[model samples]
Target: MYSIDETYKNIEAEFKPRSKWDQGVKETALAVLDSLDMPETVLPDHFGSRRALLLNGADNWREYSYGGCALVYNVDIAARFFTPSEMRRYMADGHDASMAFRGEPLLDLQARALSQAERVISRYAREH
Candidate 1:
């Protein structure tokens, strides 16, 4: 697994601005993404799968995006296994948040992504 520092360095070095005005946004976004784990493969067009993988304890999955931005934790285990409230708080105060008011949106974005992933997993489990 890539340590947070290593991930951040890679993200920082690899992240490029799509446009001149996006430089700072991309940098700050990558910084946030680097702090968490989200897979590059399953990421929906605008979502991060790595965060879900990490949260769900998916082994060998250690990548992230600006926020993994949105997430949906299993109600049965979320409170017991992770700190959703604390996560929300941090999201409100984290680097991306400091950079732009838009950062908080990641919370909702990732939640939806997680929900979709769970549905897919559930369907697969039922089939096999």
Candidate 2:
């Protein structure tokens, strides 16, 4: 099982940005992730639990949000985990509710990411 800091560092080191703007975010996110202490668990296949896993042991707000987005996308990459219709509904409800707050776009994005986190949790609940 990977420690949070180790996983975070690994993830950061692995981040190959497509643009210069993302460099700062990637670096900052890695730093924040490094500072956290998270439980070792299977990565989520759904959105909700994925976000929760990302938020686990997060010390800073930005780290919490970034992790959520990263984890959600991780699930997204699986493709087979969620149907398009389910993903669409999940994203719509999640994004609107999450993005409603007044804050940086990152926070809004994090909120959107969290909206889908529920699916991950639901899947986990059934599996266990």
Candidate 3:
């Protein structure tokens, strides 16, 4: 149960201004990945490196290139508990109409995502 103010403070620290040439997407994205605990089977290219669980619609997952940008979210082990929309809705407090604009860095959102993942994984573990 984190207050918005505390979350904002974290966002402030995470989103430090970058030089004109450095837009902080991939690095932040990889940092987010570094925070997760995934199996080695997900992607060999990212194995043992990218750590955090990724739920996009945030600055950590946005990639800008070729005159466009994309946001990314993933659900593999916990995919059965909820659809991406449902999970994101839980993250967003019900409504997701503005999910794409929730540009908080991973530092702000990682704890919540990790807690949610724990719940989902616990359920799967118990049932299976």
Per-prediction backbone clash count: 15, 8, 7
Predicted candidate 1 versus true structure: per-residue lDDT over 69-100, tens digit per residue: 32223222122222555435435544443222
lDDT against the true structure, per candidate, is 0.36, 0.43, 0.32
The parts of candidate 2 lying over 4 Å away from their true place are 1-6, 39-42, 56-128
Candidate 1: 10-residue stretch with minimal lDDT: 72-81
Residue 71 error, candidate 3, Å: 15
lDDT tens per residue, model 3, 1-128? 22223322343445443531122332333333334334232422231222222332222322221112222342221232334665566456564443332464323243344334333322222211
How does model 1 score by TM-score?
Answer: 0.26
Candidate with maximal TM-score: 2
User: What tens-digit string does per-residue lDDT give for candidate 2 at 33-84?
Assistant: 4433443544455545444555665544456556553433423322323345
TM-score of 3: 0.21
Estimated TM-score for each candidate: 0.26, 0.34, 0.21
Question: Which residue window of length 10 is worst by lDDT in model 2?
Answer: 119-128
Q: Which model is ahead, 1 or 3, in terms of lDDT? A: 1
Give the local distance difference test score of model 3.
Answer: 0.32
